[model samples]
Target: MAINIMLATAMQPLGFLSAGWLADWAQPHTSGPGRGAALVLLASGVLLVVWGLAGLRYRPLRHLEDLVPDAAPPPEADADLDAVQNRVLAA
Candidate 1:
């Protein structure tokens, strides 16, 4: 749940990131349409570098579960025993 929340928080900033990248790309680098695209491409390359440095620090949300797999199932009878013990102790 915390991982999902963290990802949601990160996603909120990505839109502004993408827009800023687009703006940088669309600006006239050399006063030509092709130059604009090239500038955008260059900006995108920088974005990739920045994202790699930051995002790589944490496994993306989809991959978080893979980082720590669920443990094996506990013994069913043991679980039942634990429940009964709790009830008796509570009483």
Candidate 2:
């Protein structure tokens, strides 16, 4: 869970950098700023489509829900509080 949080936090800046790089690359090939924006949108859409198709093609990805079991339900709030209180009293 900690690693997941760290990776998610790290990805935000990387996402911004990639978008900026894509815009720069598109700017050179297109006519104006507006055209560059359009190109970026087109490229992003293409990438999404390709990603979706790949997910569908991959068996494990396509059946992700079946591949992984659901997490156990969390302990009840009162149960957790009681356990903490008992530990404090024991200490």
The model with the greatest lDDT is 2
lDDT of 1 at 43: 72
* Reference-based lDDT, residue 27, model 2: 89
Taking the tens digit of each residue's C-alpha lDDT, what string does model 2 give over 13-84?
A: 987878877778788888866777688888779998998898899998788889799887655544778787
Q: Taking the candidates one at a time, how many backbone clashes does each contain?
A: 1, 0
The 10 consecutive residues of candidate 1 with the worst lDDT sum are 28-37
Q: Which candidate number maximizes TM-score?
A: 2
Clashing pairs in 2: none
Name the runs in model 1 displaced over 4 angstroms. 1-27, 58-67, 70-91
TM-scores of the models, in the order given: 0.36, 0.58
Candidate 2: worst 10 consecutive residues by lDDT? 72-81
Error of 2 at 1 (Å): 8.7
